[model samples]
Target chain A: SQTIHQWPATLVQPVGSPLSLECTVEGTSNPNLYWYRQAAGRGLQLLFYSVGIGQISSEVPQNLSASRPQDRQFILSSKKLLLSDSGFYLCAWVKTSGGDEQFFGPGTRLTVL
Target chain B: QKEVEQDPGPLSVPEGAIVSLNCTYSNSAFQYFMWYRQYSRKGPELLMYTYSSGNKEDGRFTAQVDKSSKYISLFIRDSQPSDSATYLCGPYGQNFVFGPGTRLSVLP
Candidate 1:
């Protein structure tokens, strides 16, 4: 069975602070990884997606960036956080073969004060 | 118009009642449709996935896709309090697009 893990399940940061969130997948290789943010009562906004190492596609322009440093490891980072950057951040992966079924890790609740 | 749209229903229903959730999209190129369920303050979980323009059924859920109408639906039978959550619709391709989740509360 495959499992996805995310760290710092809850984060509270002040404005202008640096941000780093990590996601890792086990039992799968070459999976499609994605980063999304969900605001209260709002739809999810796709931030970034990576198909392979060193390849990242950003869907929205924001204060965040993503990197696929390893095949199973993905990281979302920001140089400085904004108050608007606070939300429930989710990391999801889909098997390229399965294509449509996406598995998500327990999200990180980020609050930028 | 947004590529995908779902009613942010805060919909309330009695237990054992049938529930219907729907989404509409303007993009015709979407080949795969999926439904995700998210509990409060949790990540979304894949509940149903369908490719063809037909119905796909699981134990208590049924997912329907109508390519011609560019619409999709998720139906839940014998709803329970545990079914209270938000339902999100995703239309897929290179970048999966998620609709605004519909919040459902099943009263016991």
Candidate 2:
């Protein structure tokens, strides 16, 4: 069975501070990874998605960026955080051979003050 | 219009009652419709998915999609308090486009 892990289940950051969230998947290789920010009542917003290492497709351009360093490791980072950047950050993955069903990690609760 | 739309309902229902959740999408290219359940402050979990138009049932949950009407529905039979959570519906084509989700609370 495949499992996804996210670090710092909860985070509190000050404005203009740097932000880094890591996601790693176990038992899968070359999987499709995605980063999503979910706000209250705003729905899940796709921030970035990667098909392979060093290849990322951004959906919403802002202060956020994502990088897939290894086949199973993905990182979401920001040089400076904003108050509006506070939300539940989620990491999701889809098997390259599996259908459209996406598996999500526990998620990270980020609060920018 | 948004690609996908669902009523953001904080719907309260008694335990063992039948629950109905619905969503509509404007994209005709969406070939797969999926249902996801998310607890408070947690990531959305894929519950069920259906291809094209028709119904698919898994245990107590039934998923229905009407491609002609661009409507999708999830039905929970004999709902339980454990089922209290936000339900999200998504239409998938090139990617999955989700709704705002409906908050459901099953009162015991």
Candidate 3:
């Protein structure tokens, strides 16, 4: 069985502070990774996705950026956070078998004060 | 028009009642449809996925897709309070277009 892990389940940062969120998947290799954010009471907004290491596609223009440093490790980062950057961030992975189902991590709740 | 549209419903239903959730899309190129459930402050979980048109059932949940109408539905029979969550419908491809999601409350 495959398991996804995310850290700092909850975070609070002031505006202009740096942000880093990590996601790791065990038991899978070369999986497609994605970063998504959800505003309060709203649906998910895709931020970035990666097919392989050092390859990332930006879905929306924002202060946040994503990186696939390893086959199973993905990181979302920001040099300076904004108040609008506060939201629930999710990391997900999908198999390359042509199936569109995405498995998600527990998620990180970010609050920028 | 948005590629996918769903009613942002705060629908409240009694436990054991039948629940119906729906979504409509304007994109005909979509060949796959999916339903996801998200609890408060959690990531969305894939609950159902279907291809093309027709119905698929898993236990108490039934997913129906009508490609001709560009509509899809999820039916929960004998719903429980544990089923309370936000339901979102999306189309599959290189990029999935998600609906606004519908908030459901199964009251016990």
Candidate 4:
């Protein structure tokens, strides 16, 4: 079994501010990690994904970026935030060489004003 | 058109009622089908996973995949209020591609 954790849980940021949201996974080695944003009533949009430490692939062009500093530590960052960035941010992980079903974290609720 | 499509329904149903949720896609290469339940403002939790076209059941939940039509379905028997959430259908390949999600409310 695997567990995914994300923080700050909830956030309120002003426009043009810097942002950092962290996610970590336990009980798995070299797993694939992903960052997703969910707008009101819309499906999740993949921001970035990493197959291994320091390897990232961006799904959409945006002001947001992701980094995998460690095998299980993934960080989503923005140098300057936009109001459009406010949404439910989720971190998901899948087995590296197995199933495609994603395990998701509790998620971070961000409100940008 | 998007690769996957789901009706974003605020579907209201009474307790003990049967619930059906569906999604369709244009891609046939997708071999993995998954269903996830998402509470309001929370991350989605996977409920079912199916490979290719087939039918699989787990307790009160049944997931069906129809590759011939590029469609997938989830049926909940004796639904409960606790089942209220947005349901998403995902067709995964190298990665996962998800539907917009259908919001379900099992009213008690």
Task: Residues B1-108, candidate 3: write the lDDT tens digits.
Answer: 988889998999999999999999998899999999998878889999998799999999999999999999999999999999999999896676689899999999
C-alpha local distance difference test of each model: 0.94, 0.93, 0.92, 0.94
TM-score attained by model 2: 0.97
Chain B TM-score against the true chain B, candidate 1: 0.98
DockQ of each: 0.90, 0.83, 0.82, 0.85
Q: Mind giving the per-residue lDDT tens digits that candidate 3 earns over A4-96? A: 999889999999999999999999889999888988877888899999999999998888888998999999999999999999999999986
State the displacement of the C-alpha of residue A5, model 2, in Å, after optimal TM-score superposition.
0.5
Clashing pairs in 2: none
How much RMSD separates candidate 1 from the native structure?
Answer: 1.0
**What does candidate 1's lDDT look like per residue over B31-71, in tens digits?**
99989999998899889899889999999999999999999
Q: Which 10 consecutive residues of model 3 chain B have the lowest summed lDDT?
A: B91-100
| Fnat of every candidate, listed in order | 0.93, 0.79, 0.83, 0.86
The estimated TM-scores of all candidates read: 0.97, 0.97, 0.97, 0.97
Per-residue error for B8 in candidate 3, Å, reads 1.4
Off by over 4 Å in 4: none
**Better structure of 2 and 3 per lDDT:** 2
Alpha-carbon RMSD to native, per candidate: 1.0, 1.0, 1.0, 1.0
Off by over 4 Å in 1: none
Residue A26 displacement in candidate 3 (angstroms): 0.8
Q: Which stretches of candidate 2 lie over 4 Å from their true place?
A: none
Give the per-residue lDDT of model 2 (tens digit) for A1-113.
89999988999999999999999999888999999999867789889999999999999879999999899999999999999999999999998885688999999999999
Model 4 / residue A21 / CA error / Å: 0.6
Comparing to the true complex, what docking class would candidate 4 get? high
